[model samples]
Target: MASDSLHSTVHQQPSPNLTSFPIILKFEEVVYKVKPDHRGLCRGRSSWSSTEKTILNGITGMVFPGSIKRRTGFVAQDDVLYPHLTVSETLIFTALLRLPNSLTNNDKIAHAERVITELGLTRCRNSIVGGALIRGISGGEKKRVSIGQEMLINPSLLLLDEPTSGLDSTTAQRILTTIKGVARGGRTVVTTIHQPSSRLYHMFDKVVVLSEGRCIYNGPASAAMEYFSSIGFSTSITLNPADFLLDLANGIAPDPEHASEQSEGLEQERKLTREALISAYDKNIAPKLKLEISNSRMDIYSFNKHASSRNDPTKAEQWCTSWWYQFKVLLQRGLKERRYEAFNRLRIFQVISVAFLGGLLWWHTPESHIQDRVALLFFFSVFWGFYPLYNAVFTFPQERRMLIKERSSGMYRLSSYFMARTIGDLPLELALPTAFVFIIYWMGGLKPHPVTFILSLLVVLYSVLVSQSLGLAFGAILMEIKQATTLASVTTLVFLIAGGYYVQQIPPFIAWLKYLSYSYYCYKLLLGVQYDEEDYYECSNGVLCRVEDFGPIKSMGLNQLWVDVLMMALMLVGYRLVAYLALRRVR
Candidate 1:
């Protein structure tokens, strides 16, 4: 059989000089399955019950020693990177977070620099890894950056999922050449490619072709055409070997002798051809591969034990850096990533425009216009309430994919990430509100007391935090941007209506909701800051009336100022706790 010849050739080939830590990857009877449609709609069923869909059925093979997941570097097809970060910054952060703590910061950075040079990214090292919205690095450079991230750990085995995908032929060739260089460094590189060109196909030492979740061919790339030809699937035209193999895998062959067939017949022929190829592989190749695996001295378990005894760097602790260190790095990264969004001109314009509009409308009204003053204060509560809510709502959803990728790689503790994210945004979140309060409070001319203005600023800032917390909670709980924003919209509207501004005499059944609204407390506190219970204002009839006797002010007195502050504080902590817990549940 052709398998015997292929096996002999493979065994007779001389081993190249490998590095100290060469990894050989082997698998036997690896069965992988998943439920494709959880709702069972694919099977014409309305229930949630679903059947298992086999993706890899009894897959068996090996790449020269074996591979451990921890020691294996994986680069996903899509590059999930912070658009704001430069290529150097991206690799540096990854190295700091992913490398073992045994190494010093300088050593980690040095390693990153080496990887940058090795990956030919020195020229564009400072260029940002841009996303859909931003234009930064080229596609090839981004892919290399993704690879360089994995290379930071110096993995023995590197697994890349379509690393060359979406690149042109020249760029794809360069990427493959880089990977080949990596493989030459005693690392086993396994990648999945689709319809590679002839030049690309020849670069691979070994190739495995699968048909309907079954191995149709598992041998050297150079010998693939010969093996197929021996199995009555030869081609005369000088087609790319990868293309030919793909055609064979799809149950088609380039044969001028055969006539053009109908669609139905072609499908049946393809099925039959696939079955024949699978059967041939089972009979010819499976036995030899199984025997080789059985004869291997170092199995996966023994290799792992040996690796553990050696105290390999790849098998280091789950978290490489301390919580504080992680927090510090992530905090810096978050600040850099969000600086543009936080301080953008458009956002600044929106806040300043609204602040000035409110200032101009209220424009230093006298103390006699208590109602207008109260309206302005309520507007402050409502504006700050939803503004931060909408802005913070997109936080978790936007970073969800990036979080999942990094966390799965065990980059940092979720606590550090959560803390850094929320805390780093504090200054940015408060900046606009601080400016708004300063502008409107001075322009509206309500309560000329210095202490009163300071108190109002403090309350507005406090309200900003509470509103941002609630938005974060919604975002973390529902990691869908549209859904979270919608929920936030509904929630803020409810709080606005129930904040006791437009309606003072809320029904007893729903009066409890006002207590739940942070805006209600903030509004009451602003009024308390402006006037005392005994302070009098001229009514519409020129009668002097106690300021606290107004309907809204009377109902919400200053006696519960401490209670209101306490509630706001509780909400500040409570919502954040909810957000953190919800984030924990994310996979």
Candidate 2:
């Protein structure tokens, strides 16, 4: 599918933020629904939401695009998220993801700068990106940065879940002013709001009242009081519109004698007002948007061979300037993703500590107890398995929003991202863990053979890949971080026990679990490397080394080299594929 498709239903207007012109977005009979099974259960609800009833199954709304008012804003936290990224990179990523290539880097930078100026974040342009871009910038500016990201796409339509959350009244007003400015620029911005105070109530261009899933009113905020008045209901000036709307939709308590008449009057007016407003807007406003506006990019280089009026730096003759040139645009971005991983740093420290501790444990191990071998198995299982289980709970959700946006926009394919991430991280795994394996094996005086040392490193790297894959898989299905984390813990335990750490031979009842234990292959692989390639028995004497293969189908296995390589390869591919497919949800 193409990244963007525009409908002819585009309308233009102006708002308080601008004196000239802006865009307005309107929805006609739009409806949203969820399956009955997925409906929320915590409203003390015994019966699920009905599967039928078209009117109660969905919500319909309309509003000016991109314009948020002081009292009516979306529910978004105003916090910076990345400290390592410069203000430039954050915008660049958004522009790259949303804006077309027609908008060159210079255009993007300029546009972002304009937004930066508007949001009062110009001074922090070079600020490091961190959680919410917070260190050098204020929370309000960070919220504006998010607004800027949305603006870079030049969307005439904006949908915000919540915009005024976590901000003081002054900051909230400033943000609302910026949103109003967007609407004045000709965009439709719709936001869902909780009950807002009286001061904030008058800022909205329109008030859309919803009860349960039904739309009761969709019209001007000013006429809201009068609209209810005609139905013989009085609205207080101090009453929040949202709360008043809730009461109107739910109705007053049923007094058996007057209940029927009250219900009849309310239902008739509700139906009449809803239909009347829907028609007024649908016929007049919605119909006005029935025009097409195709935005295009200007070829700048040819217009100016030298940097005169246009500041185009690209050469016209350069193949990179050709149309339909689909190649990676931001090398620095890809580098950043590949350059540093929290896991990598942690892995390095882990390797060093393990190497030192292991060395001491197996020191002079010709007389060492069987505990050394047992401890090694336990350590590897805990280390490798623990990561996947824990990360599986968080990795997906944390990256879920950004991942879905980028993936949906066709920035890159899921397979490509997976492959690039895998390739990019493998070298890190090799480098970070190699020293640890070397220090431990040599200090512990285990197998010091060169081939065996290298193979051990390979095992660590492969194990890492498997773990990352599991992380992606977990993210795909779980909605909450806690659920995923708990599940991951259980899964890790199962893998560890089934991995031959607790018992070499499996009871028939849980015998099938052996196949799922990645450590089963890892133990075998490390043993094979030490057994055949290194002089392990001679070096460690009888103490540190484990002697046998930890597998049910030991006789059925192929050559140790082929068998281990094949298993590692298959597990890597298997989990990665599962992760890749899971990643498709990101799209």
Candidate 3:
């Protein structure tokens, strides 16, 4: 019955009284040009020398809407969803932001429920929308969920790109059937698909074939083979109509009368090239299209109905939601996703492994052997600095695509996402280093006083945060994990060399590099907390001790401890600011 109604609607003549609301999307002589890559540093090229490709050239078509709404939704090829959020949570978040503030929470949820039922996703509504690393709903269900997301806004026209790219035939058919039901109920849906099955091909009312970005055919799906044959192409009853049409567009279709023969002469005689097809379409179809466009405009102008405008009552509302609401939602989602990643079992094991090994190697350092204490303190600074720095290099790069999708959709502000991410990982960032310090500090038999122990832990924690921020900045700036990791390693190595411990005799020209070294400040602060001036260090029996008075802190001037602390704090803010700027530039 639904298919019959859809068929009838397609063949039916345009009438103003046919439906209370009708929308027609029309584009005349549309041309889309691809911009050249601008990342290169080439200023010598002349403006007249161009290298831009045209994807769509002078194509004109009209997509008439069944309902009287202008709400259009687009589902991209990639299924961009928050992997951690469940299906219900995903739709609810979209509804909360996209639906007008006039709707109550219950009303919004009820609408979401209706869409889930309509799309046959009720069984998986509570399931997580996982990614490659995790298990979640099936691909078919995920596609449906993606569609259901758009349904919450009640769009009149829904555009989809390759909706069945990865699904099995049965699943693809089911998805198409669901979409057909939507079209039958007075909605205009335009979807692009790669080679679909014969049954699936017939499901569409009209078919448009393009070759090398040029439309060669646009007509009823049933009449496509006849149209191609009329244009000196060949087809067979045994062949899938879609396959035949595609081959015809690609200039590979066999002769209709002589299946075993290929004819170049006929192609030349018919002017069978992309240019010829485009020209033929203009001459043969443009007249019909102009009439269709004129009729659609007349029907649309007959009545002035703006259902979509009222449907989205908050169209004039700023920022989708209140500032606090966006922040709260983003914070909750970030924390949930980061909790799984930051405290991964492998990371915990690695931290513990390092701590235990360091503790055993430096066990019970004697007070007279002050050299061991200094080495251990420097190790503390470098370990936390290096570990967190490399670990964070992958964070932003991994989430970049997801960030781009959300930002393009106008989901939230870049500032909000940057702030939330920086703040979200603080728990694990502080926790891991503190735990590592607790295990090693007592085991190495360092300063055991309560104030000394607490201060040491605080210093290590702050150092880890600084490293994490640097990692974020590098990841955001590079936007690729491999490149960012390589650069981060080199940058961290340079800082380590200038950290005041490894190379004490700094040349005057490069002495300014020490101020930029996060490890330098952290090392100075940790040393200050451990030892002071006038402390005596007795050399062990038959052993030579370095020229340390056991007061590594006083030697560097005790007043500089606060300055080091202040510097590390400033670097934290500085790195985060840089990361934010990099993200803004990327968008």
Top candidate, metric lDDT:
1
Question: lDDT of candidate 2?
Answer: 0.55
Model 2: CA > 4 A from native: 1-26, 29-86, 126-138, 194-203, 209-351, 367-382, 385-393, 405-412, 416-431, 477-480, 498-502, 505-513, 533-558
Backbone clashes, candidate 1: 3
Winner of 1 and 3 under TM-score = 1
lDDT of 1 by residue, 164-272 (tens): 8899999999999888776766567788989988998888888889877788888888888888888788877889888888888888856845634688878887888
- Order of candidates by TM-score, top first? 1, 3, 2
Model 1 CA deviation exceeding 4 Å by range = 1-22, 34-52, 65-70, 297-302, 312-316, 540-542
TM-score for each candidate, following the candidate numbering? 0.92, 0.67, 0.84
Candidate 2 local lDDT, 414-474, one digit each (tens): 5555555445445554564556566665666555568767776777666766766666577
Tens digits of per-residue lDDT for model 3, 372-396: 8888999999999998889889878
